[model samples]
Target: MFLSRCPLSHTRSGTAGSEAPATGETSLGDSLGTFRRQQDILTPAELAGMSVDIVGAGALGGAILLCLCKMGFGITNTLTVTDFDRCEAHNLPTQWFRPSDVLMDQAKVDALAEMVGWVCDRPITTACDRFRGDESRRLGPVVILAVDSLRERQLIWNNLRNREDVQLLVDARMGAEVLEIHCLDPRPSRRGTTRPAGPGTREFYEESLARPDEAFQEPCTHRGILYTTLGAAALVGSILRAHAREEDYPRHLVFDFRNFILLAHGEGHGETQF
Candidate 1:
């Protein structure tokens, strides 16, 4: 729900059978008028100057992209999307795509960028190759990892953790029964200290490697568009909340889709592994 506002504040309210005043038709001398007022509600200037590099344009990544674009994030945010996968027939039910988009001669990132370009107008930079090579890496103030592979997560953690400029990193694992959100605030010092700060330095990585891979299966055997969408919405909210606030929120959160429970970690937490 939107915030309630007094109509006397130069914002005209429509009567029972009358239409609201259109833009440029308002007698008020306000430059932005109501639009600026709404922009004040949740201005995305914090995300304006930052370049956001996203990996894995699958269900989770696609949802995040839509929310970010609708939030009025600048196109110049240097959007770099990389995905080697293509949209399949089965993906049409769970992932964001159209029948017309099916079997297109393009990668997932390319197809998504094309769809988003209609809203953003500016073309987004897309890479068809997997985000594996050193040259394929990009150091941004914020990096989003929505990939499904454990090895890929380890690689990204190793490459981006020690950078002094990178402020935040977020990872989401939306499984069938549970949705896990992992966040990391890259700083030299934090609550936990298992390792020294430097390149290839992450205590969480060492721990995760010692353990076996955690097995998971989809909750609903067939893709449920509803659950996928709901999880996506929750993930996007967390991302925007982190950016809008002056400080970070939690380092980890989990949502049990079966029981409908949401859990968050305490503050001062360090980097976390999958």
Candidate 2:
């Protein structure tokens, strides 16, 4: 649903939309009118200087990219996407891709880069390699982890935890009907969590790893839904946007889509593992 709203880039000849409306193109001045009003929370200047690197280009990452592009984030900030995965037939339902995309056999990051280039007309750097834990591997100042496996996520956190350049880290995860978004900004002396501030990531990873039922496919499998993916990505984008503006929201956020309950980290907020 949210993907429908992203104004994407298009090649003049092979573009998706052939017709340019009689109203003509909307100028950045007209499209960016909302930013001027939200100057208190997030101004264009603040978002301009930050560089964002998203680890995975799946459902969550795709939505986040589209949202950021629509908001004109890449106008000044550098947005780098890294994903080695390709779009398959199964991804058509949950991810933002057309039938033609599956046949192209293109990398997820490349496809997104093309789309975003058309939308914002901004250059998007893409990497077709996995994000292995490397201390010297620097994509940008901010990192967003949307990878599938637990080990991969932990590896990234451990590598960039103490790095001086890393300003923010956001991990977006989802279960059958719940989505959790965790943010971490490390300072040498000041700390928030007991350890590196995983926000239930360690517990969730261990439980999923030990679950015997996960070995065999059951009738009811834990898969991400299109609606849930959009919801989750919106929350991730919102949290990152708040982080850029230095606004106060939540260090950890868990939302229950089934019950329509939203909880933020605090005294009563439970750190539930997926």
Candidate 3:
């Protein structure tokens, strides 16, 4: 079930000022009212109280976070991001780090928070440490797992699969022009029920996991492409939008950008090519 929208008061970052508006100029509130067109799909008010935790600050994670920010998500509740890696020169092409961030030797989560703050007023919480599935603190209801390696995915899933607090888990995997997304509901299935709550059944997701060595390793230079990363982020945004709208969405989706083909299953099922 989706959360209900309520009255909320939010201050847009960089919009606060004592100066009055010049003649014929738009007010700060008017300028920040950019979501009217999308109000039918989702309004900023609906996202006010939602909390989200995003693991990893690499290509997919960085892009996804930016997308959420632009959509006015996590405005009332801060978005939490955890990552141990620092921004490097190589992350410029596919990730969201700027050259200045690399020169400053900023941690990925910190850099992402700073960058996001510039465009969005929403607050972000950063953890400059790795997530090992054994944190003392509780995670938000929504978790987006974008860490590298199948082992990390397996470990994190094992920790969250049975947790009642975690309602939605979105996992994104990418390799060059190929991208896969899994939107799983971690709540346990009802008693004596044969079907799982979401499309990402434990059995199906577990089958996708394997040893690190068993997975194909993309060459360093071809590991991430800017367009592919953005595409994956867009898909992730669509899933969030569906949830906000209380509509059905694909539980699992795979996209091959090179061939312009998409394969999706669960609530929405289809195979199409352009």
Candidate 4:
């Protein structure tokens, strides 16, 4: 019998079949073979050579990373994650870390990377420090900005707005039951360009970034909810799926889990139940 080598299995090492099977024995298929189920929706070819940078490993960031891992995104894609905080007891309720992770006092990115290793073969480049726009030379073409503060978002956007290397940016914000996601293209506008994002997009994003002190402050207990974070992650996955297909997606969206309402803005403006 002839065994077919799976292309998506190349990155995964030391799985069940690294050794040659004994004579007359059948080999267990590679770990990524399960991806066959979603072949029609997203193939490994669509994600080949893709690189993504996730700038936070808090509630929404951790949830999104797990969702992507389960979707076989790491098969042929590079992922980099940055976060400076350490796991704590409070994080357990909303974030992805286990109780043991908090006991060990692991950094958020480090703990998240370890969890990703268990879920998939994707190697995550972790930075246990804050992301400073001035210090960064270039980020991945696709960036997920999941930082908590409005000021941090402003700083990141200022650094990325004029960058030619960055094409897509997804910003996720959540407060207990309400979630907001913004998708932007940071490239400068050119005449006759048909890109979905341009000067108008930048202006709209800037308007949403009010002073941090002025923004509504939810009590610590009401800041994050697991279901809301998961909902945000699912919406992010939808945006990425559309991007992988080279299709258009909403530029901004808001989902109120408590009310079961979803409002999409820019290009595809509508209200519906989520």
Candidate 5:
């Protein structure tokens, strides 16, 4: 039997089985380097013309911002981030931040946005203010509600609900070792008269910002765990990719890292182990 020809034989450099490229010519690998170095499975055009707006820069929000950046979100899409918080020593444990950024007179969004721009070669806009009220505005069509409290989430959601400009919403909530991710399109339910339209003559849903203590904010130590956020950020990245592909994504996902359990909602809810 005759030996087969080597695949590398076709590579340029005017020599058989050579990987090097000739001067003035780019190699195939060089051409696809950008594509292959991507941290996401989604295509480069994945957010395309649409921009992203993230409302928080804490554990969950910070993780999501960095995750999307790694996935080439910064390169392909304009990213608008908003937060009224600052980076402190305690935040270094759970959020994507550096120690030197602690006292730079920079807001959380300003610091991270700068880092992301430098690292990703894409400049992202920053708003060092809180999002509030009905009839408010959004920086982009897609919004990520990564705020700390339920009341904050409700406020932003209710405000964004009426905006024809706001089309997609990704809500992320983390509790100890578990996190809930919900992707909402905010489309009016088409099944009218299918049953008596449930409560609220008109409804724009948001989570209850209720916490056990008299204090609403999470204790500094209880912000989040490193492990839980890694998994949650990866999952939310998947959600963004699914949106890019126009695939049917989970309306709600609750992942419990404590027991390795996963709860996903379809038309209804179901649970399973990862």
Candidate 6:
């Protein structure tokens, strides 16, 4: 028995052999592959633009704005910041403000945008008022609530939750030694509803600017420049990643700078130790 010769030897036999391109059309297959390859190389315009509105211009917000602007994302993806407070003398070192910026009405939006324009050639927009009332409703979809008080955080959610456009809500707080970053991604079914508090926590839908012994203007802790910016910048980078993907992360990242360890807390309900 000759054993039917080698199957690979006959290119045109047995229904055009399995080695040939599907349907005997290498050109079509090559074209389809090339199309997919080209699709993967999408431009900035093709990607969903990022419009980040940061509330507060203290250590966290200032650092986050500086880092994001320096990254040179784009002009169209505007950064609109809101802060009714000005930079204080003590915040000079850790915060991004300089001596010249003192008493000069360093509105968070204007000052940060000016810096972005000078350095990144990207101009950030401004809304010098507080991130509440009818004016704040203009800024939707992405909100970085970096305020100092729980009251302010609650107020931010009240405004953001009612809106349909806002998808990502990031709340980052840094004490003297610990830093916590909370992220709430919109749900598919109730994407427009107000954000419900995490499993055991109370719903802070009406965050006012009042909490005696811990006033909105009161500074909770004296964080060094290293940890403040380090933690806030990291959180901003994480939010940007989530924004770029338009998805939710698996856990909340808590950075304990004093211990030099990063802890990720699971969703649903759980505690994590660094």
Q: Best-fitting candidate, measured by TM-score? A: 3
Report the backbone clash tally of model 6: 2
Candidate 5, 1-274: lDDT as tens digits: 6322222112112222334222223233324565575545575565676678887877777778878866767555566677777788878888766787787644677567656545544445666666662424445667788887776666666666566665667878787787887666553442232123221112213322334233234555665788888898899888888778777666668798888888775422333335
Q: Compose the digit string of candidate 3's lDDT tens values, residues 1-274.
A: 6321211112223222222222233334435777788888777666654668899989899899999878767554557788878889988988887899789776777667667767764556667776765566777778899899888988887778767777778989998788988877766652223245335666566667756677658888778788998899899998988876778888889899999988888765543333
lDDT for model 3: 0.73
- What TM-score does candidate 6 reach? 0.67
Q: Model 1, 1-274: lDDT tens per residue?
A: 6322212111112121233233223223222342365464455444556666677778778777666655544333555667777777767766666666665533577567666655433334566666652443445566677787666777766656556656666667666667766655654454254234321234543354334266344445643455655576556555655565655565566777778777765354343333
Clash pairs for candidate 2 = 8-119, 9-118, 9-119
lDDT agreement of model 4 with the native: 0.70
- Better lDDT candidate (2, 6): 2
Q: Candidate 5: which pairs clash?
A: 150-209
- Residue ranges of candidate 5 with Cα displaced over 4 Å: 1-32, 37-40, 133-138, 187-220, 267-274
Clashing pairs in 3: none
Clashing pairs in 6: 141-166, 155-207
Which pairs clash in model 1?
176-219
RMSD of each: 12.3, 7.9, 8.3, 9.1, 14.3, 20.3
Look at candidate 6 and tell me the lDDT of residue 184. 59
Using lDDT as the measure, the top candidate is 3
Question: Could you tell me which residue pairs clash in candidate 4?
Answer: none
Ranking by TM-score: 3, 4, 5, 2, 1, 6
User: What ordering of candidates by lDDT runs from best to worst?
Assistant: 3, 4, 2, 5, 1, 6
lDDT, model 4, position 126: 65
> Who is ahead in lDDT, 2 or 4?
4
Give Cα-based local distance difference scores for all models: 0.56, 0.63, 0.73, 0.70, 0.62, 0.55
